[model samples]
Target: MTTPADRGRRGKDARKRVPRSSHAVWVPPVDRPDAVAVLERQGRDRLTELLPIRYGRMSASPFAFLRGAAAVMAADLASQPHTGLTVQLCGDAHLLNFGLYASPERALLFDLNDFDETFPGPFEWDVKRLAASVVVAARENGHSPAKARRAAQETVAAYRATMRRLARLGELAVWYQRIDAERLLPLVRSDADRRRAEATLTRARRRTSLQALGRLTEVVDGRRRIIHDPPLVEPAGASDAAALRKIFSDYRSTLSEERRLLLDRYRFVDAARKVVGVGSVGLRCFLVLLTGRDADDPLFLQIKEARTSVLEEHLPHGPYVHPGHRVVAGQRLLQAAGDIFLGWMSGPQGRAYYWRQLRDMKGSADVAGMNPGALWSYARLCGTALARAHARSGDRIAIAAYLGSADTFERAVTEYALAYADQTTTDHATLTAAIAAGVVPASPDV
Candidate 1:
């Protein structure tokens, strides 16, 4: 077994191959794939009718474009030299991807919520994506470039600091680390921010299956059923519903015996085809409503199709062959606490799908209009949460050694973030221009 000193030396050795200072460099290669073409390729297997919604959502703003363009960014990152310090990356670790969710113990925790693109890769890839997101989000909030750079730097600094701190701890101690929602309020700098944080937490706690039942279902002819919102939330057709019911047992089989027993308590009520996120817009996603004891007690499960990670194409093959299993395994490995219902199974047409609670007190920060100070605080929190997650799956001692005490990595990542933010803006323009020229079909702001 390698000692701590050996791991530290290994990390230091990586620097000679890819210096920390090299992270700041960003010049899109002349033969870089067209951003629009990449999006087109990703959408090929997705629901064709929903492709317009994806394009429309992505065209809303530069940040929105970045949110939906993980494939594009993955390719860009792969082009650059990296530290080669591998971790199970939150492959699309943008600002909004980190949020609050209820752990099995019923405590709310802030962690990475999206795993559609999760895969093992260089740790710096996740950090760079996160830093670039901070810059884009800050710019969208109308902050000065200096403030944006500061926010990005703070993100990397917090990550480096947190990783170093975790590295010194025993294995079990590091494994138990998490950012509770209660701990978030102390980090706020102002009364208003405190109130906002409190409000966010309160809102998250109320976002339970019961709340979803009221909002997403209605009594139709004295029977509770999922409400129809057309295109976005429509009743699954007979064939789709049959497929879901047939695969329900298969999904349950993937869970532990206790979890399966708990799931068996709820009777599947109804299901609907739903449109989810910007990048995941066209993917096959369904909301399954189930009732426990009686109609009043409810449970909501999301069955989302899992595809090959964008990072997978750039990096070597990971351990899992089943994409859904890969997502579930990655989430379990990285999260300090995970949902009890987390599982995966093959679906109709041999597509891979994962199952999890639809809304277990889940909430995301409304980052749209945050002021500079607020954004910086949020960015730092995300950074810390990210570091905690990486420490769980990666070599914390090695990563900490690679980062060192100096802010060289932070500064380099900040510089790269600013440059990539510019690239994101250009790509956003390219997408919107394609929409205007009728080169790609885009439904208007649905």
Candidate 2:
């Protein structure tokens, strides 16, 4: 049997792509359920369909380009080197995707922030996406192409070193020891970096379930309710509310006996329709407020609508598991420590999506204005983290063997990222043209 380590030792050929079996599961097109079609459609409906994909509409000119370029980039990325080592990918693990959050013990934790489009697929796919993100971010920040290339090269280089280092570590050591905020201090480079790091730690320390409950829960005329704001969210309708009461019964079956028993103490006070995320905009998401003893003690849960992974069609299907279940589990596997309330369940509409605390001290790194060195450093961290994630799931030894020396993979990916960055530019132009022609509604904010 070729263990991952043994494969790593064999040198490169073993890691080469083997013939793959056909996809096992059938995922619907992005156009499924009518809502996603707008995004899938281009030209006539291109800009309009592009709205949900863009977050914070006016945050930056480049973000609009990024959103518009997804379909374009996905088509391009579908054409890269694939390491059949499938695990839940962050789908978009850019520098911005990493953030500070609280562990169950309330310690500050920094890890991957986004997971939509997460599914089993090629490991290189993630590195490619992240590298492109850096490029896009660089372009937005007015960095020259040479600077962007430097950032990408450094990131890929770091990824190679990190994977090689982890490959040598005791398996248990690699698995158990995480770079938590508390322990990650040794990695900081400067006083300025340390200030931001310490600030994140301070914020993470203040986060708790109590904070999630405080921000999301409220009492409405003596009935506990999860607050709602229009377009963004609204209270669940009477009919759906009734259905959730029944579904809650079934949902209980999915939890552990103890968790079900613990939940039994709380009454499902109120539920509301909520909208969330950029790529996931318009997908069904909801907030459910559960109270224990009285309205004062509360738990806030966002029951997001999960859909088939965007990667499912592009790559072979992974092990059989509920999409929502796959997300929560994959996330746990990738992150050192995930949100304590990180759990999965099906909802009233029968639509699938994962849910978790909305805030929990969530804050990501600032990518714009970063010097070439900082960008390189940041890329290294992202690549290293991504490598660790892959190693945890599949045979890293085989991967290391295949990767051989970091030089080839790094060079190949840099070339690929550079070419793809050009493609992204074209797609952005396509979107901009569409917006001008009324093909899509381009918001100015993001």
Candidate 3:
């Protein structure tokens, strides 16, 4: 495990090497009988028990199947020999998770979004996931494997090259900043792409507190209310409402004294159980809207269900994980700008995750709908953003050293992406069959 001080130190101190003779640790093969058994056992269809499963499923559409595909691929890739440079990885590093967002200073920056499977594991784990997603998403968008593979190689190449570049620059440059969108655009290939990037930037510009107010709070009967569509109730139930308030009350303790003081400016205004994300369909996720003083002064917060990371059960662990801190700690380590209101607390009702700002000009690049030219642009962005995130938590030099200059790493990831994509098709088939047999009832909508 890396200490805060150890992580802060320059160079090799930040990263630890994982032995890679193909025999250092036992990584399971997903195609093996045991691995298949584990997936089925872990898989479920109940809304709560299956929320993660659904999250994975919904995340696997024409535009985005890669995010939901990580667990399946992780099970497959874990069976392979890796360089074992374990650092905190976003776990799911698809292009969609890389998006344009406004930094606190109001600068439009791009960064990693999802981190549920984040853990200190082989950095390549993040790479393979990104590459495979590039392929899967590209194929969905009608790109040839030749194009997709090249795009995948581009992603692997960018991660390796950037890490090496940052490694040479030393720790300060890696930690003190990120590759902003302006610096990022020149890497994209097409005129359509440059235009699309500009449009996303335009959207990001439009994401602010004032815009956030429209999506979260609305005037109903002349009183402001957070929108709700039953089952995902707004305001919660009477007694449950009070308990929800209590949860937020305790959540304040997780923040620093300084942040807590900043939060004093805002008071809870409205809260409700919001059905969010395809995967989180059944778990309890609450949306809390806050007001600074008057009704027009608004802010939004989300309290989601935090479950055990899939990485916890499979990979060789690094840090001691207190269940209460899983989401918060993992997120801070994995994302560049996590929710300022991000905090964690556990209750007898089970674990609930609290975060702020549900929407802020937040939108994903549509990979499935993208032209082949745009897929390359999108893949590179996700790859670079993910690498930037890893460089923050671990030593870049050692990692860049392990990756080397050859196409060896890119070849390895491309090979793995193909293998895992096959495994996902097989698993998806099994899931499809399970639904057909009525073992897992198919939602007519799905």
Candidate 4:
């Protein structure tokens, strides 16, 4: 095995490909499409009827537009210089994507919770996505320009610090490290921050399957099934259920023996097409309800459509032919712990899909309401989690050495983020203009 010192030396060599200071520069590609075209291209694979809703959600705010424009950013980032460092990127590693979720051991852990666009890509791509999100989120919260810069700086600083620390530890030790509520509380800057974090965790703990059961389903005609709410949750055709069961049986084969045996106890109840987040509104996503032992015991699985990652256009192709397998594999590689029932399957029409618990104590920080101080603290937590995730897949020693002891990389990222934030605003305005001209259909009332 290579020593940390050797890895450090190897990392220093990366400066030749992309000098450390070169990272500070931001040059928009001349061939980049107008924002409308990017949005149109992304909607091509989506459900035609739901594309308008997706546009509406994205048009709500600049931050919302940034959230849904991961592919657009991916194309831009691909044009930038990189040091050739790669990791299993969350691909869409925005601030909201970092959250608290229950592990199989029932521990509420803080980590990257989204992986729809996960793939191997330049490490800086994830960092850039996160840093720009800080600025966009801060601006949305009515923070001052200085505060936005500080938030971006704080996030990258935390990432640097965490990576430096992890570089000293053995690989196994670093892999075993996890951040839970107890570990996260001390990082808070004040009593109010602690209370907020605790409150969020408390709220998440209450969001079990029972809570979802009460909210999303009701008894109809002596049967408990998902409720139909137009443009959000709706029933599938009666014939769809049997086909899904057949498809799900194939999903079961992908699970471990113990998990498969455990899952055998639950009987399928019903499934529904559900509209989810801003970026995923049009994709094929389903909420599958299952009953175990009795009506009181319920399990909800989210089956999400998986396609070729946005990063795939820029990065090399992975070995997996099934996109669902790529998502499952990337999630396991980046997350410290994952759902017990995490698996992948082929859809009825042969599209790829991956399944996991829909809402197992899941909670995200309310970025819109955060003050500068609170946002700074939250940024640090996200940076730490992101560093840990990258360290798990990339050479921590090398990346840390490249970052060095100073604030060079952090400052550069802050500058890049500010520049990118301006670009994002311009792009968002283009989208707004297109919508006004009826070029891109959007319905806020929906």
Top lDDT hit = 1
On the 0 to 100 scale, the lDDT of residue 365 in model 1 is 91
Write candidate 4's Cα lDDT for 1-446 as tens digits: 87778899878888778777777788887887777787788789789999999888888888999999998999899988787877789999999999989989999999999999999877889998999999999998999999999999999999999999999998789989889866667767778888987899899999999999999999999999999998789887676677788898889999999999989999999999899999888999989999998999999999989988888988888768899999999899899998888999998788899999998998998889888999998898999999999999988888998888989899999999999999889888888888899988997756
- Give the true-structure RMSD of model 1: 0.7
Per-residue lDDT over 247-339 for candidate 3, one digit per residue giving the tens place of the 0 to 100 score: 776788998888788788988777787766543456567777788877777777777766656666567764745544765787777666666
Whole-model lDDT per candidate? 0.95, 0.63, 0.65, 0.89
When summed lDDT is taken over every stretch of 10 residues in candidate 3, the lowest stretch is 18-27
Residue 351 miss distance in model 3 (angstroms): 1.9
Error of 2 at 287 (Å): 1.6
TM-score of each: 0.99, 0.83, 0.85, 0.98
* Residue pairs with backbone atoms closer than 3 Å in model 3 (clashes): 28-79, 54-279, 55-279, 60-65
The Cα error of candidate 2 at residue 377, in Å, is 3.0
User: 1 or 4, which is superior by lDDT?
Assistant: 1
lDDT of 1: 0.95
Which candidate wins on TM-score?
1
User: For model 4, what is the alpha-carbon lDDT of residue 1?
Assistant: 89
* lDDT score, candidate 2: 0.63
Candidate 1 displacement at residue 213 in angstroms: 0.9
